[model samples]
Target: MTTALIRPTADLYDSWAAAVNEFDGVHIDGSGLQAPVVPGRVTLDALIRDAAVLADTTVAPPEDRVHNDLYWIVDDREVVGFLSFRHTLNDWLREAGGHIGYAVRPSRRRQGYASAALALALDRAREIGLERVFITCDDDNVASARTIERAGGVLQDISDQTERGHSLLRRYWIAL
Candidate 1:
């Protein structure tokens, strides 16, 4: 298999449109994920602009939000997954979310795209000077836990969060 590449969305809206339609126009959880393709690419253009603004560390978010960067995990110019790096953890994130979040297209699962994308995300984290990055997966999501372990994540603790739909969360930390 050809190696996957991580790139920001630019002129790839056409390719992205196809992926968006693959899920019948439902916007999934990924930075610049699927959205309805309107005439003239207006929606795509707006998404691109928002992604750029989100990447800017200088801009401060409301008290609840944290800094983050969004990236697409591409292979052969097709988007297979997306990775979002939370530059720092807020209190809510520390207990639940974490430093990074990612989701591979259902059709591309089990193809090693997730692991590769995570490695790429970690490189970005290191570049940003993070000493350790926290990652979490639902306890029931064995595949996700395996992906995390493959990327050098060490088991830290299990957090219970039934109220959030995640019955139990297995939190891990990767040392940079």
Candidate 2:
């Protein structure tokens, strides 16, 4: 199935939250996951707010938010996954975050959603003046690595990240 990358909407947010809540097996990482509510209002609000940040270029937020937190949605009917983009040359971003991030819904895993969604996002990145993109996956996440590789990502290096308690990060880059 084809997936389109678009801006996040209220309905999309709702669906994303519902998917997260319903799919207990898929570990939704990134932001605001510790709250008691599965598909909580607070999380939705944050998603909306972040979308606004990505859209607004005038009054950009702090370096991390500006360089790292901006994301675009790959909504396949509902928001099945998200693609985040940042300039890899940025110091902090290159070290830990990289240029892109993504996740597929648990129920939607093993399908081509992640690879397809990432390709769409890479087009967006190139449109935004990026010649290449840096992406990272946990070393243990073979699926993620495969998705990246399938999307034409070339391995840069393997590094250990202490933030997630010794999780290894497999970094890759896709030249646009």
**Candidate 1, superposed: residue stretches over 4 Å from native:** 2-10, 21-27, 32-43
| Per-candidate alpha-carbon RMSD to the true structure | 3.0, 3.0
lDDT of 2 by residue, 1-176 (tens): 76776555566666767666755644444332333446667767776776666556567565555543444345446766666655435665676667777766677678787777777778878777898888888889999999889888899998988775548888898898
lDDT of 1 by residue, 13-95 (tens): 66666655556555455555545533237766776676777677888864677777877778888877677888899987798
Best by TM-score: 1
Query: Clashing residue pairs, candidate 2?
Result: none
Candidate 2, superposed: residue stretches over 4 Å from native: 22-37, 67-76, 87-89, 163-166
- Candidate 2 global lDDT: 0.68
- State the lDDT at 33 in candidate 1: 50
TM-score of each: 0.83, 0.81
Prediction 1 TM-score vs. true = 0.83
